[model samples]
Target: MSASRRTEARLLSHDEQQLVRTTHHPAIYEHGLDALHELRRRLRALRDRERTLLHHKMREIRGKAEPRGGSFPGLADHPGRRRQLFAQALKRVNAEASRLARMTARAVIGDGARRALALRKTGEQWLRPAPSPSPAPAPDPRPRPNRRGKSHIPGRQVGSVSQANRRAQAARDARPAPPA
Candidate 1:
């Protein structure tokens, strides 16, 4: 962080402290944390909204720039130029939104601002378009051996009782009941 940013952070922290002192309510810190989270959420939402709007404007520009059928033979390149202009506009808007989000994060988030920034950066990195997947490896030609021995049965029937146990239970039940 730059010196100016450090000073600004300190000032914000001081202000936050003052606010906490004035409130004097139990769970004030929890409330403050909630407020910080809400601020971050709102900023991110605003960025998303701005990005969507820019995308829409880009589409509109593309539509307008395109020449109609049987319109003009020499004007085909105009659409490309217009498209470039719209793309630049979109980029500028996205950049400004990012800057504003950074400022808001710096101002609203206190001690954990650095962590939050790092998390945001990682999140953005994660959201980037994924690279093409590698080719699947060839399956092994050799058949896999069963780990269990012959005694081990695959997919045993549910509630199946052993023959020996059944016989033993039957014998015990068949025995004459002892006089109570």
Candidate 2:
């Protein structure tokens, strides 16, 4: 065979194909790692934003012009403006905190999934066998006690003072007047 054809034939060997198959997933793993890193960075950014907003709110509450130990003057003493700013800052901080929490949760779940996949790829058996699902308990055969019955006055209707007052007033009005 010609030299180029020989090289091509070598490239198409079973071992070469197997090697490619074995190493093909590195790109996928690398992508997963990159995504995890990005998520961590975003979580940090959100946390920082939340901290800054909280500090601003604290300063507003204390009637300080600037944050503690800072040279800047505190905010103006307008209670309306302070209230508005405090509300706005609180909203922003809450939003950022929520976003960070969600991102962290997602990152944790994603990392767990990736680790499980890696473990599966390594062909190592779990230390313990998975627990077998237990059968559901049988339903009880005894009949349930009947709760709905006459003479069981519901609490709402039993002790209503307004109803009692109305009944008493009707009874009083219905009585015949004494002879003049």
Candidate 3:
């Protein structure tokens, strides 16, 4: 919140932003950021070694002749340009790092939202009563045996029962009938 993040949606608080930098992994992310770092470092090195480079180039070209601006006019701005390039590349890396941090903050927020929704659903479930188990409607008292005749309970195979169905049936059987 020092200024603002351009890459992400405006959401996180300052503390959350701090958390984003350290906690959520700033991924190498396809080597783009690392490459920018390399570029910036090389540019700074070039700027630092400017005198040596100029002396080498001048000695190779001319033994004793002094250089004037007309021969190498751009040389005057070469150090500035190198410095500028390094700063720009550093700025690019900083921007991308900020973007990754914002993304991580967004992910933490999303996960929290999901967890909060689950908690809300659980709260509602705990507040509400579970449906009572009930016996199936009256079946045929004189139904014939399975395989050769119809089942006592319609739509239910004579011997086919799942563990859940068995548990439900046991629960139903265990409950005494309510008084009229």
Query: Which candidate gets the maximum TM-score versus the true structure?
Result: 3
Residue clash pairs of candidate 3: none
**What is the per-residue lDDT of model 2 for residues 65-109, given as tens digits with 9 covering 90 to 100?**
455354433332232333333333334334444655688799999
- Model 3 lDDT vs. the true structure? 0.52
Per-residue lDDT tens digits for candidate 1, residues 67-164, read 33454344232433333333333343344446556876877776477766887877755356786698865576676899877755455643356766
Residue 165's C-alpha lDDT in candidate 2?
99
TM-score of 1: 0.24
Off by over 4 Å in 3: 1-29, 32-77, 124-180
lDDT at 139 for candidate 1?
A: 72
**lDDT against the true structure, each candidate:** 0.47, 0.51, 0.52
Candidate 1 residue-wise lDDT at 8: 28
Off by over 4 Å in 2: 1-77, 130-180
Clashes of each: 0, 5, 0
